[model samples]
Target: MAKVIMVQGTMSNAGKSLIAAGLCRIFKQDGCRTAPFKSQNMALNSFITTEGLEMGRAQVMQAEAAGIAPMVCMNPILLKPTNHTGSQVIVNGEVLGNMSAREYFAYKKQLIPDIKRAFRKLEEYADIIVIEGAGSPAEINLKENDIVNMGLAEMVDAPVLLVGDIDRGGVFAQLLGTLMLLEDSERERVKGLIINKFRGDKSILDPGVKMLYEKGNVPVVGVVPYMELALEDEDSLTERFDQKEEGLIDIAVIHYPRISNFTDFNVFEQMPEVTVRYVTSISELHHPDMIFLPGSKNTMGDLKWMRQNGLEAVIKRMAEDIPVFGICGGYQMSGYEISDPYQVEEGGKIRGMELLPVVTVLQSEKKRCQTKGKIGMLKGCFHELFECEYQGYEIHMGQTSYMLNNSVQNVCENVISENGKNVYGSYVHGLFDHGNIAYRIVKILAEKKGIRIKDGVFEDYQVFKEKQYDKLADTLRRYLDMEEIYGMLREAHLE
Candidate 1:
């Protein structure tokens, strides 16, 4: 069995996920077989495994840091929010059903057995397991049925490392207030305290750090510096959405209220000559070289929202001048019509953006699989990418029909398309994961603007990500007390 250590944050987006991933990388570098576990996760950013099973993207990122293949066992229960009050619950990579917040709160305790079974499966092969907790353990009302935080820590006999985000302010209050709220036993379970995302001098924070130690009665373990690393985020709270910068090649992604898999465009953000901005309104949509309609959890509702806010009309006008691209739900919305006979989304028929010669039907059955082939079937803006080999995954519930008589290229085995030879859409995610596809896209955009780029065109996305994981591990080793952490793991082994 693997020795377990749990990381619990003071609140959501307190950098718990990255901290856990850093530990995973550290363990892997030290030659330990490490894995990450999160009993429950609620996020729109998700991935499909080789088994065609769905799991949260954060665990997949952590699995990458550990240098291992991602498994469904790493994340057993995933809750994807379809709206403000309800989510579609998935267990062991399969959909259980949708439930309201109140309904799920009352029913979550019943899933304890499934969580345990998944943890045991990870234990069979892993030498060390780093578990991540959701939201905050101090959410007092939900503590009774809390299978993700202190409850799971107790169940697995794991000591907790409580993390407070210094960047969000009130570092002392955030740490001490949370300790006061926990039950005595739960408070005792917290073995160390970490202050994350510190941007300034250590001398200035020392007095407060001592105060936190005295008040919370836990040893201060680390003060991780704020890192500018390219990593996948779990939810919409990511700061990437707030960036409004524009570069030589401007690419705007439509930021729907329920956007899923926005990670699809993260690669572009890393390029110095390109800017990928998430636009929510007409003001943010200014004259981009390309427009991307991203995946959404509620496609019909988001499309309606765009219609009401007048973004839909503006995008249609812009599509005549700029190239427009979409994926999955976005692809469905770009078509001529959509009907939800199976009620997969909001029931009823609706007119689409009509950018492409295709129609979609929302189906109850979701199609998911990994795919790889040459990019030999596109037109217009993607003409430069002909025969460029690509690898990615497809995941969606809508069945699209190409209106063949309407000048369609039916590009790339129907995984991507060229309509009117100007508009494009694809059902695949991670299209830029492995090659110069991103480079070619930028080159196409730059050519349109009559500009020249001098950077090298080839990019191995996996190799780039591996360098980032190493950077994370190196940062943690310098600031964090890893010898103390190793001691805690040794204690777990002795127990």
Candidate 2:
């Protein structure tokens, strides 16, 4: 059996995923076979494995940090929120159907067997398993059937490292309050406490750290400094959306309420000459060189939101002059109409932006797969993308077909565009992560706007991500108590 160490946070977005990824990297560097496991993940940001299995992107990021291929077993259960009270549940690698919050809460306990089986599969290949927990283990109302936090820790007999976010303020209350809420056995499982995202001198925090240790009866493992990492964020709470426009090339992204896979645009942030901003309202939607529509979890609902908020009209008017691009759900929304007879969303039929010459039918089944193909022959503004070979993944629930005798042409195998060619739509995410795609697009827009770009393009994003992982491991090693962490794993082996 593999020794297990779990990272649980005081609240959501408390750096649990990054800390687990850092530990995975550290373990791999120490020459131990390492893998990451998250029993259940509830997020819109997801990934499609090479084997065509769907999983949460958080585990995939952790697996990458550990230098291992991503697998659905790493995240056995994924809950993607489709609405306020419901989610589409994925078990192992396939869809199990959508369930309301109450329905899933009652049904989750029955999946314990599947969770244990996933753990056993990881144990067979890994010497150490870095487990990541969702939300807070102290959510008392949710503690009963929780299979992702303390519940999973106890099930696997894994020691926990409870992490608190110092940057969010109330670190003391967050940590101590969580400990106060846990049962005696659950509290005992937490072997250490980590204060993450610290931005000040350690001396000032020393007094509080000491008190926390005395109160919680756990060692203060580390006060990790705030480091700007170019890593893929887990979900919509990511700081990427808060970025202010700075770069010469401005790309405005419509900030949909249920946006998913926004990481598709992370590569643009790597370029010094490009600025990617998320605009929510008409006031914030300044005239940009290009407008981008991102993937959404609930296409019909979000489209209704756009119409109600006046974004639908604003984007259609903007598309008349500027280059407009859409991906996945956004791609579906850019078409003439979207029909959901199966009730994938609340609306049965809705009109699209009419930017593309196609119609979409939302289906019960989802398409999840990794694809590689060259961009088809294109015209007009985005002709730069012509014949560009790119690799990306597709994750959506609808199929789009061109309207009869429409002048719009297929841009790629999975992409379509209007005849005017200023508007483009595709179901492929991560389309900009490949060779010169983002660069060429930005360059063309910059030239049209008469703005000069000094830097040509960025390095391979995969290489850039690997370097970030190394930096993450180095940061953890420098700040965290490695000897103590290693001792925990060693003791687990002896047991």
Candidate 3:
């Protein structure tokens, strides 16, 4: 059996996923075949593999870190929230069904065998497997049925490295509190603790580390310095995003209550001059060059939310001047009105921004697959920019009916837009990843703002990320006690 070591965190967004990726890269660089595994992930951001299978983007980034092709099995189970109380479950990259939080908890255990099978397959080819645990294992109530944290550790009998963000302060408390909350067996699984995202002098933390070791009865393996790694974040509250200011384009994205696929803008953020900001208040809408309405799991509810926040009126006012782009739920919101007969979100016809003379009807069937189509001549202010064909895909639930030819037209049957500036919507996410498509839009926006863009303005996002992973791997190699980590993994395999 291949050596397996899990990276569990003291809390959510504790840098567990990033640490896992760095470890995977380090192992691969050491001439060992490595892969990343996460028992389960719950997030709105997702990616479609080359096989047309859906998976969390974090696993994909980790795969890239390991110099391996991404696979659906890497993330066998994914839960995308459709609303606060309910989520759409995806097993093996296929839509299982929608389940409420309570229902999911009751049924999640039965999927353990599937997770084990996927892990076994990965182990067969990999010399090492870096598993990531979701949230925290210290949740007393969830520990019983926990397949993602301690339960997964016990299932695979894998040694774990508990990671805590030292920069957040209370690092000792977070680590100690987690250890205190875990059962005896769960605590035994933790081989060491890593103080991650540390800043300032390491010697200053020596006393704190000494105290931690004395009290927690676990070795302080290493104090990892705060490294700015440009990788895709696993969840909404990404620390990387929190640190950076908006880029150049002055993009104001409407913050929906049930936003899904906001990760679609990850590609746009690659441009040095593009600024992507999420705004909830109407005052923040300002004079953005472009307004993007992102996908929402709940269309009618988000539409209702827009009206409640006076965003419906604000969006209409902005549409008249600048270009408005919508995707999925945002695309549904671009029509004249949206009607949900099935009571998907409070059940009824809701008034839309009425920018485009179109209507969208919510349906039961959800589109949960990969798409690829060429971008043609999209009629809009961006036409001169996106004149050439590009490629992308679509994922949405509502069906749109356009009232006029000018109201909506498909460019190469992929990109969608209304007469010039009023409305632009598409099901395609990650459309800006393609450099040509990205540069064209930036060029137009720059011209509109009386600015000029130099050549190679939009860097290739994948290449940029690979460079980031390389730097991250180097950082991990320097700071982390790799020998100690390898020894723990070997012990797990022997067991």
Candidate 4:
């Protein structure tokens, strides 16, 4: 059986995911076969494994840190919020349909068997499993049938490291209050406490750490300083959206309400001349050198939102003069029409922006796989993209067909659009991840805008990410009491 260590946070975005990932890297560095587990995860961001299984991106990121291929078993239950009240539930990489908050709460307990099966699968492959918890475990009202935090810890016989975000303020209260709310057995599961995202002197926090240990009855294992990382964020709480007009080349990303896989554009931030900004309204959608439409979870719903908010009209008008690119659901919206006869997404056919000579129809079976191909013949402003080979992944529920016309052309094996125009659309995510593709796009945009850009190539994204994992592990080793952590794991395995 694999030894297990779990990280539980005082609140959502309390650094649980990153901590879990850091531990996975540490365990891998220590020559242990490691894997990450999250019984339940609620996030818009997700990934498709090699076997065409869907899982939370957090586990996928951790799997990368552990030097393992991402697996669906890492995240057994993924809840993607489609609206304010309901989420599309996925179990073991397959969708179980949408359910309201009230409905899912009642139905979740029935999934314990499935969760256990996934854990067992991970146990077969790993020497140690680093489990991550969703949100806070101290919600006493919702603790009855909980299986993500203390309940999961008990099930796996895992020791817990409770983490609190000091940057959010009230760190002492967050830690002590959480422990006080838990039942005696649940509280005892926490072997250590970590104050994360500290931005001040360690000496100034020494007194509070002592008091936290005394009140929570757990050792203060670490005071982790806030480190800027370029890792993919799990949800909308990501601060990357806050950056606007920072670089020489202005690239605007239409911020849809249910945006999925926004990480597709993370590579652009690596370019010295590129400024990636998320624009939500017409006011924020000023003149930009390039415009990008990102993937959306609810294609029809987000299209309706864009129409209602007057963004649809603005995007169509902007496409005539500026370079407009779309991926996944955004690619669907760029076409002439979208049909959902199978009720895949709220049902009924809707008119698209008419920028591309294509039509999309949502299907029950989702396409989830990695793909690689060279760019085909291109025309007009985007002719620079011609013959460029790229690699990416596809995860969508619709199929698009190009309208038969001499003007329209297939840009790639999986990408279709009208030629002799600036507008382009494709279902491939991570199209810009390649340094060559990203550099070409930036160079073209800089030439168009007459902005002088330095001659330098962007770093390979995969190499950049690997270095980040090493940096994260180095930071954790400096602050976290690894001796005590290993001791807890040793004791758990001995039992």
lDDT per residue as tens, model 1, 346-400? 8999999988778888889878788888876677777777888888888888878
Mark the regions of model 3 whose C-alpha exceeds 4 Å error after superposition: 239-248, 341-346, 385-392, 404-412, 420-422, 491-495
Steric clashes per prediction: 0, 0, 10, 0
Q: Measured by TM-score, how close is model 1 to the native structure?
A: 0.96
Per-residue alpha-carbon lDDT of candidate 4 for residues 109-182, written as tens digits (9 for 90 to 100): 99999999999888899999999998899998889889898888888888999999999899999999999999
TM-score between model 4 and native = 0.96
Show where candidate 1 strays beyond 4 Å.
Answer: 405-415, 419-421, 455-458, 490-495
| Candidate 2 Cα outliers beyond 4 Å, as residue runs | 406-412, 455-457, 490-495
lDDT of 3 by residue, 129-206 (tens): 899999888888887788998888888888999999887889999999999998888888899999999989999889
Ranking by TM-score: 1, 2, 4, 3
Residue 71 of model 3: what lDDT?
A: 86
Per-candidate local distance difference test? 0.87, 0.88, 0.80, 0.87
Q: Which ten residues in a row have the lowest lDDT in candidate 1?
A: 407-416
